[model samples]
Target: MSSNTFKQAAEAARSKTSAMNKQSSEAVSAVKNDFLHTPVMRAALPFINGGISGMVATIVIQPIDMIKVRLQLAGEGGTTGPRPSPLSVTKDIIAQGKALDLYTGLSAGLLRQAVYTTARLGFFDTFLKGLSARAKAKGRDVTFVERASAGLAAGGIAAFIGNPADLALIRMQSDGLKPVAERKNYKSVIDALSSIVKSEGVTALWSGATPTVARAMALNVGQLAFFSEAKAQLKAHTQWSPLSQTLTASAIAGFFASFLSLPFDFVKTRLQKQHRGPDGKLPYRSMTDCFIKVAKQEGLTRFYRGFGTYYMRIAPHAMVTLIVVDYLGWLTQ
Candidate 1:
């Protein structure tokens, strides 16, 4: 063939290949859009599943969590007598109340999880949507940084709003009493707030605000950023079902986040448990004081007394919740 004819033939072949590639891309895009846009019948599945999983996990680990509180309050100087290991603590709780004591605060825990998960997950979706809308109004895209900031803000707000219920739940769990018996009966979340205000004062509701906020920030960032990345990567690289992918990603994120925030949790539990002096004031007084006291009294290792239980509870909780939530969503769809 002549050189000009050969060149024309090559151009024609290239054009055909490009056209095919574009068509293929468009077809894939359509499939994805359809799958995503279809109305899932069980959109509420994730929230319900997440709440149940969290409640169950909390109950299972309640004893260890109780021990963690006791150890945290003992301070850094350490326990006065022989220190009980996690296993010993577990045995003690079982002996004290048997299975019932092991699940001392089951009702409170379930309530807390139901409220917290609902608010946290519900508000997260709402905040992201609001941010997206705001960005669109400004003729801008919501960047990763913006999304992260939104998560932080949303988490903080949710934590604050949910703080009182959390405080009551913790107290009820550690103290194992309804407010009425303690002369601080909180019939509901609002009743708890009012009772605390009437007796301990409004500030009592925010006993461990600092640590709570910090934990919230860590959790939100971990879940939003890590979950998003992990889901994308898993879908792209693996052949796992969506349920498996969601559970694995959520479990990894929850474990790391929960582990990182354990120290703060240790402090928060201590601060919350410490009795007010005869004058009705907090014993530790402040976060710094609590930290110094724990370090000086209990030693560094005390900060991690229930590490194993923490991991066990969080990993399964996250995995189960995320998977169930996704499954519910799929079913509804």
Candidate 2:
């Protein structure tokens, strides 16, 4: 061929290659859109599942959570009486108030789970989709790490937003000594929130923010990373439907995440309880002090107080939350 003809041929080949590359990129984009879209269509399932599961799990584990909080809040050997083990705490409640005590704060716990879990799951998915879209617009692929980072951010933000409800839930669960008159004063969630803010000040609502943030960060990391990985692995090995896969993966993720963050949770619960000294300020003063004091008085094992309950609550909570969220997204689509 002539030199001009050869140059034209080379240019044609280059143009064809560019067109093929564009097509491949579009195909990848289409696949990602499908993946994201599937979840959105079934979004209602996740909300329902998460709400129900979280409420049930919280009720089942509230007593152990109560014990955990009590152990955490107890001053250095300043208990009302002998300390009870996790198992004994339940027995004590049963002996004293029957099943009612164990289910203390059931309403508060249900409200919290309903709000926080829905927000966390909903916002996390929304944020992830936005981030993925942004990445795609920049001609980039969204990595698992990116997804996890988004999840962490979403969790932290959600925790901060829902911190007030969380405080109320904790207070209701652990307020064993407060009189019936005082307890009955706050009728609704808003009433309880208003009462706390008025009596304890707005800052009281965020008493355990440090540990709450830490827990949220850890939880998101575990859920996003582990849940994603588990789903992928399950899909590879089993022919389960999307719902089944989502539920199984979420349960595994929730269990491990809860286990990992149990210590921080223990600390957070301890610090938030009414530990005021004579000056009407918190006795522990800070998260560090709370940790140090608990360690000194109750030993390191105490830091993991109610760990079994933590696992039991978290595993099902996470599983249900994920499954419900995923299913909801599916239904919507």
Candidate 3:
């Protein structure tokens, strides 16, 4: 009687286990089919979503970005004249004009994000997918370095293409530190580009292309590679919610990006705002020359003069943009 009961119980347990496995496999297959059918995963959706997310983030961070640029352009030696802090810059900008003047280059910023962020993010995703597929086919996993390279390449290309908008942004922000009479008073990003082309030639639009592209490459590294790694690590090791994980990863990525790119940004701003004289001669001969002049006159610290303001701008912008992107993706699913 005991042996018969034991055999019956074992047989029932095996059958139950087999049925559960079958049900689990079916559920997984259903989810996979649904994912494949979703339009959000289409090739071009990343670019569209990336642009929307970037524009939204840019709008929210525009003020901070203005303050950062002002701080970057303030003072000669990073401490020579009356030193300008973020609060002082904000006060000056608001005191001089409408409080909204703090968003002087909103149009250009949005346009730049639309062009730069869309391409950088979209290209990276496309390259990543291709690499991942190949790796999977070959029975291997994609490496972090490969992903970082993709981010770098995408950013460089996008930044170069979007240099006109970027140059306009710097020019608009540069006016904040100038007397009203001397200011260009660009009406919009379009006006700024037209004026530059008319007065300075179309090539002037890409005045700071070198440093801008470099900054973009570094930013991509931070925003994509570092953020991806951080997020993956957070998910694997922590019990944090999706929002927390994104915020934490974005913060870390933003800091890295800002730190790596600020020096290049300072140079980009300086170069973009410079104009040739009557003789078609410019103050700075090249990126290296500008770096030397600023370093000699403003000191080495000038390159990082706006660290706090930049971090303030970059971190929240990165976090919000990524969060929005993730939210949109999740909603689609």
Candidate 4:
């Protein structure tokens, strides 16, 4: 072929490639637009984004969470038991098995996030919008009480819905505490759920549900409500950038969340970790009973025993989740 013929062929190929690229770009744009513009997707976006964010945060913060749990369970049953530090707990966990042992029950944790975070965030966002609209109609701003109410309602609902997964997570995390011969040795979240159901019935999956719900409500009020309020206040009062505001707000929220929720979380873990004794009786009769017994036997201060570790876990998790959710919302918008 002559030089001109070869040039003409190359030019034609370039044009065709450009055309295909343009078509592909257009298709992607169309799909994105459809998703963003659709009513169903718009409504579901908060839940989806919240779940993804929560899972990502959980993956990063799992080690700290494991340490916190171990720390909480260290002095079980009495005040004169072992007082384990976070470093000690980490070393103990690693010594028992491998580093991955620290990530026990990660499957159940992810599933809990899928249900709990999704529902809590989605409902909070939905309720916030309604509250904002109502306040606007009244020619006023949304009060902190309104924000807290939204968080409480969302957390209670989500915690109840996610109790089974939460229970499985607690059971799996605490399994290693048992004697090797007595361990259930759950292979996965499914295994844990199935084993619990088979051995104790479906309702067993919701063990410690009362404390779980209370913890969720406390956490959400501390986290969601405080985060929103702090961010708003920062935005109004400070010259900080949006990122700075988010970070500060999240840090504040995390501290409050850890502080407010740790007692209930402690009780929840204790309850979920217990099974029927050889005498066919559980340790604590109910949430109230657990609280009373713990205060009487373990001392009131025991509830806050792992505050530092809990803050480390809760703060980082809250920061990551909120930051990711904010980023996702921006991207979707």
- True-structure RMSD, every candidate: 13.1, 14.2, 9.6, 2.2
lDDT string, candidate 4, 92-164, tens digits: 8899999999999999999999999999999999999999999999999999999999999999999999999
The total of clashing pairs for model 1 equals 22
> Which residue pairs in model 3 clash with each other?
none
Per-model CA lDDT versus the true structure: 0.66, 0.71, 0.87, 0.94
What is the Å distance of residue 190 in model 4 from its true position?
0.3
| TM-score of each model, in listed order | 0.70, 0.73, 0.85, 0.94
TM-score of candidate 1 to 2 decimals: 0.70
Q: Which candidate number would show the highest TM-score if scored against the true structure?
A: 4
Candidate 3 local Cα displacement, residue 300, angstroms: 1.2
Question: Considering lDDT, where higher is better, how would the candidates rank from best to worst?
Answer: 4, 3, 2, 1
* Clash count of each predicted structure: 22, 21, 0, 0
Best by lDDT: 4
At residue 132, give the lDDT of candidate 2: 77
Worst 10 residues of 2 by lDDT: 71-80
Off by over 4 Å in 1: 1-64, 67-71, 74-80, 129-147, 176-198
